[model samples]
Target chain A: MPRWVRHRYASLVVLAVVIALLPLLFPSSYYYRVAALVWVSALAAIGLNILMGKAGQVSLGHAGFFGIGAYAVAIGPTHLGVPPLASLLIGAVLSAALAYLVGRPILRLKGHYLAIATLGLGVLVALVITTEIRWTGGPDGMPVKKLVVFGWRASGADTWYWITAGMLLIGTWLALNLDDTPTGRAFRALHDSEIAARVAGVHVDRFKLQAFVIAAVYASLAGSALALMNGFVNPDQAGFLHSVEMVTMVVLGGLGSVIGSIVGAAVLIMLPQALTVFQEYEHLLLGFLIIVSMIFMRDGIVPMLAKLPGRRA
Target chain B: MSKQSHFKTLFAAAAIALPASMMSFAGTASAQQTVKIGSVLSVTGPASFLGEPEDKTLRMYVDKINAAGGVAGKKLELVIYDDGGDANKARTFATRLVEDDKVVAMVGGSTTGTTMAMIPVFEEAQVPFISLAGAIEVVDPVRKYVFKTPHTDKMACEKIFENLKQRKFTKIAMISGTDGFGASMRAQCVKVAPTYDVQIVAEETYGPRDSDMTAQLTKIKAVPGIQAVVNPGFGQGPAIVTRNYAQLGMSSTPLYQSHGVASKSFIELAGPAAEGVRLPAAALLVGDKLPDNDPQKKVVLDYKKTFEATANQPVSTFGGHAYDGLNILVEAMQRANGADPKKVRDEIEKTKGFVGTGGIVNMSPTDHLGLDLSAFRMLEVKGGDWALLPPGT
Candidate 1:
């Protein structure tokens, strides 16, 4: 193997080892619960980075797919009698198919128009989930069945921590691998200039659609994992606010970096928990921190850090 | 390149400075010396209207109790988290309270979805959770560690149906929001209407944020044999429904609201349309108007006085739930004689005839809420405020 290839994967290997050793640091199940939430959100953020950072496509309504993924697990077990694990797979497939259908036409739009189109898609999904009270449980939400493998039912924050962390590692690995492939180059080409990419025979339309679908699947899997972990699912999981939150996580984490995704998820999730100590001033302080970070770190935390005096390539 | 390095240096300084700032705010609690009680409320966001008062009530009551010598001779420590009405955040805070804070009990959940989300957490940890939200499903299956203070939607339905029977209004029209609270109340009302010999002539539903329900109300008004209109929901939907009902000049058709809108804000929002409106509410709303012989009078008055003085706001029914929850937990602690979670769980289940701002609660192994239909007082908006209707009138 080439030394360049080996060096390129060194950080991913370090991340895997770090995740494997994190259980020893957990003070209680509470830490594990929060760790799982961070991992689940990171998984979604990493996939989103591929679309937003690599392909330069912005989706303000990806929570629509996330909500679909959650409802798949929630409704599948109770209504279809499918096991939780199978339902997760069902959710991923459905999300991918929906993304393909939705992305084909909507992906043709550029810049803010694409964002608005995705936003509409998300709002429509939330409305359907809210109005279909009989099956979706309306706004109050429905209980999700625990994921059981053989006879062992999945419970506890520790169990979810390991499961979500493993899934996140796999998701990051795939995204990193995609970044080095021909399709990844095609995505970058289109991102820089779509007309130039089309003239260069890069299949601009197909690669953009591929990125959208892949991101949708990643969000779906994360959503399914979250619903199973919490034992609940609601329409808000697919609402516009959640979509905005996912986008914020990707941008805040340094756009295209897998490690940045993890850092972004950790900062946002833990910042709120840490701010609880502030009591009445929690929201005010949180808003201040977000604004300050965005103003200073224009390219995101990781990308900016990589440009350090001693670290520049 | 210099700017990039400058940001790197700045962020490095920020990374070091951030933890130091957090450390200044952090203080270790003496966990063994105090009986720690944790609570999760939607103190901000859309549900802040419900959570703000609940948070104030708990703080006021906890201070009052500790000032009076504390529960079981141990100083009480209250740890509260704002969930912002999100279930995922509620679950996280509930776990943090149980595992990190090591709270022996919990006492607040301002929304039914949030309370239900935390049920498995409390049940798994074996900590007694006294929920302030009103959802029968929270305690219907009877988890050993979960209890609630507010009356259930089923109870509210029965109260409304019984009132309809008293008025000889056999035919009725219903309009509800499509939200969780509205959906649950609509289900319960439909389930109980037949038992009271009342037929629902027209059934219509509106979205949660719909500013006008005239289209739906107009459809109901067109239905023949409709004697009354019932709107079961919280927030602006019911208020809008009231305005639309009056605007259509259906003044002869009595309008009924569910207990979800039992608040001064509802009256204010609905304007003059709220006059002559009827609903079932906790006795706390009409505390001053209650007869001297009423059992809940003293408890309601005391809660209203202390909570108003501390919170600097008028008492709300949502706040009354928090007051009842804390008081019930304190009473259970006195009976159990310790802060052990298992003992508190057992003692809370044995609670009976405890007069609260909501009503007199009677608990059994099967009933966690410990309140029956009697907990709801039939209230009418006589002028601009809630007025208790005379019994059997």
Candidate 2:
């Protein structure tokens, strides 16, 4: 068996085992809800990792795609009479198309200029969602219709837990497999050096756009999952702060590592919950904790641990 | 050597460590004799101004209730989660409150967004939830388990219009913020204006963060016979608008603000420009000034004194909303003789003439928020302080 295939099978098995076993320790359904959130957030971070980690491109506007998916599920069922599942698919397609259109021009810019352009895109999406109060419910947001799969109604934390966990596994598997793909190799080549990749005839721009499009689909799917699970959608889902959060998760989880992205999502999502015990000092303590973690493991938790002397790659 | 083994070990360790750490903090087992009350508030983020006071108020009141020999003869146990103004986090905390803590009653949603997010969780769990948010949508359709203490934006508009009617002023211009609270209040005012014999001849909007509303005010000033200019916004925007209105020398036309700026900070922020500015607010702001004959006088004064003494800060109407929410829930729990969620919900629904910091609440089957226009007190900023206006004008 190929080494990459074995690696993919191993990661999937471990993730599946963790998902299957975590419930044994969950004292109540609330943990399931929280875990579901971690999974959904991780899925988005993994999508972002493809752009940031694999392609060495930064996107601060990923949440705009997330908002599209969330609103699609919300507006589709309520106004368009489309099924929630179908709306999720439609959102992904829409996000991919938008990413392609927008990435063509903005992705050409590098570093801070590209960052600023993406930031503007995110702010614009948030403004539209907030101003279109008639459809989007303004800043107060609107309730999403319950996702119904055939005869089964997707409600409850436990149901969403299984669904989101399954989705995360698939997302991780796809990301892991992409590591060895021709497009994935091209992304890595461009990430190493754009000029070098161009000299090697890697079609740098096309690969960057492809990574952006794939990342958008991932974010859109994650957003739909979250909206469905929460039974609500709001403009904050697409806000600039959320985009910053996605980038933070990717960077903190070990940039290009699939497992690292998931780990980063888990830490960021769960740390706040854990730190709620600090009462009014919650934010202060959270900041302190993040600073401490970064000081100890600068390359992110998973990557730093995996690089331990005894662990052979 | 396969890299898979190393990855597998790391994954297993992480997965176990994360849940294990969370489980350690899963709340220690308590005796069943305690009545659990859960709350999810935006205590640490942008809306912390509302939630901080609310959190302080709940902790103070719960301690007071427990010291007063507890509600329904069972100790009151409070479980609170600060959602940091994130609606998604608020929803998760709501689930934890309902499922993990198994709270019979819940209070606290400092903002409209947080309240709206948690409404479904409480409704699905059949837990009695009294919100402190200022949105009308919270109790409009009357969800069985949902109630609110704060006056809705619609009531604010109505009270202002009623004041306008008393003054016999029909022509008005509106400069509203384009944010959620401002936009919704503006819409409510527009919807209810004709019924009050008021016409909004000129209308303009300012962004939430805009420092100067001079341009909008200028446009409103251009309109002929603009009797009064109403600014329906909260935060620093209203204060800036007040300053801009003063700077523009539009004092001849009376200025009105919504209940969103019913805090001492608004008066402080607007400074001398706030003079003669009128807005609808709760009785809590004018607790010391209320006549002896008023029904809410004693309740309002007592809450003010206790909250001020304990919190070490002047009381805010936002805190008063939490005060009202808790008292309503406790009173319902006392009447039901226990903390059974269904009984408490029904009792809360049947609450009548319960004097609170906000006003005299009279809930019913159809009306979740039973306070009428009478509950709102029209106050004018006089000499850099709130001065209660008489019922008519």
Candidate 3:
């Protein structure tokens, strides 16, 4: 455990400092806003990493939890008069509880069954958001009351960058801490060999459910953060493509490592902005990149980059 | 004395550098003597049909202005990008145009989803946006920076419902797209159902690419008094709905389709089943039979010739909406004299009597959308062409 901590400690500190100073480099508030989006997406991907990467579970419909988080912020404030901060917490708790109930029976299904069930769960949430027009603003999405902190509303890009950065830092720390714990070992063992882990006294079912619910809460909070930051929530945020994008981000980054997931999301999100000239070919290029990267470097970009030495390859 | 002078000198230097540098930079940028305009549209996606025409229209008009020695003594530099039916992408493109591309005014987003996504980008960047999309939500808050040039879904629904009443078809079955467009019309259809004294007895929905909608249409057919079926959106949606309805032997029941399907292609796609399909369209479009003396006729003919020669495809009303949106924004930018974001936005908000391919546009702070309900002409599809309905028939 001490050795594990020592190995990750330097990387964690480096990530924190880089994220802290990112806003200073941005030329405008727009880039800060984009950075905020990255943080929110990272939050969701980290949650899924616990399930897909850690526990070897499949959930193609994680956007459902994400939407629940967003809509909770919208519904809680406007309908129930709950404050935005509380609404975010309440949304997370609600999504976790729901995930616990949903994951119990469905988690038993292996592979494709798990994938399709999760996909259906996401679609069901989207259908509800779209159909319940009187509440969710229909497909147009409703504007959320802006999030406030310390008697001040975060009005500029710089403030939001700091706020989201703070959240990501705390989230990353908590996630990193989890990796060295006994639960983390059990999860790893279960992933490597489920039957063997069971024989070795791992509570596979309980741990799977727990990881799924915890990830659900994380996704919910991420969704709430996005809605609060943007001051709007739409069906598109919770749509099917968002679910697919989350899974893609999870895989693109080193799945087993939370840091890898972060790198994956940041690259995918910022790649489009960088490759503006061959803009039309973005989807084609990204698809090809995903295929080639997985085929050649199964460990993902981080592991591949780490392979280079002093006179780096 | 040294300390006081140090503070005074630093403050003076800061104040002097700010305006002096800005003035010199501004002098060089605007020194070229041309207005800079921005266009945000999906040149690639499902809605590219609208974006391509919008880009062509803006480029053509900008070229025409430059050839005539520029608008207000400056050539128009058009900056364009694709939204790709993704809101996040639209937001990114909006920022790029306003920040990196340094465009003064922006135009063109055909889908409600993309336009809504770009709203905050324009709001925060303070770039003036003129959209080809007709979603009411785009201008619902009436943001100072956002303006639309096309008729909205609400206006279309009211115009369409009133036209149906004129045709003496009250009991209507409704079919709508399963996406935002479908939901928008479905909501409007239900709300206005009581006003028009029309009962929407049955409503059926199908996803955009669904291989079969026979189940939903069959339910509508069983609803006995459904004298006509109303489809809110055009494109592949109404085309498929009409074909299915025809096979079910409801061809003569006065099927009403939204102005969205104003293209003559819907009739062709529906084939033998589309003989009596009623659609509300902009008067300027499918007015090929109008006399040469009419100004509307001239506009349509000129657009057709230019559009066909360019895109090598028949021009639909959506393309006309794009042409109107860009043409009107350019007119307003011309009125404002240069690319001052605030001046351009304010001038566009107060625009009036601006005529283009779609209809005469008159914008205001309260009404960001320029065209009125009367902009739509009720037409019937007869033998694969749009025919204006008989006067009070």
The C-alpha TM-scores of every prediction are: 0.96, 0.97, 0.90
DockQ of 1: 0.34
Could you report the Cα RMSD, in angstroms, for every candidate shown? 3.1, 2.0, 8.3
Residues B1-393, candidate 3: write the lDDT tens digits.
123322322222222123222322221233356567777777777777767777676677677668888766677787676666676667666766766567777877777777876777678878888877867778877888888877777777887788778778788888888667777877777887788888888887877667566788888878887777888865587788888888887776778888777766677778878888877778766667765675567777787788778778777777777777667776776788776888878888888877667777788888888778667777888877778886564
Candidate 2 segments whose C-alpha is farther than 4 A from its true place: A1-6, A309-313, B1-17, B20-25
Model 1 chain B: lowest-lDDT 10 consecutive positions:
B12-21
Give the alpha carbon lDDT tens digit for every residue of B200-305 in model 1.
Answer: 9889999888888889988998998898888889998999999988999997899999899998999999999988999999999999998999999999998899
Please give the TM-score that candidate 3 achieves against the real structure. 0.90
Put down candidate 2 lDDT per residue, A1-313, tens digits, no spaces.
3455345567667778788988888878888998899899999999999999999999999899999999999999998999999999999999999999999999999999999998888888889999888888988999999999887999999999999999998998899889778998999999999999999999988999999999999999999999999999988899999998999888887888888888888888887877777776778887887888889989877777766744553
Per-model TM-score of chain B:
0.93, 0.95, 0.88
- Candidate 3, pairs of clashing residues: B33-B74
Q: lDDT (0-100) at residue A308 of candidate 3?
A: 31
TM-score, first chain, each model:
0.96, 0.96, 0.94
Best by TM-score: 2
- Superposed by TM-score, candidate 3 places the C-alpha of residue A57 at a distance from the truth, in angstroms, of 1.3
Candidate 1 local lDDT, residue A112:
92
Model 1 chain A: weakest 10-residue lDDT segment is: A1-10
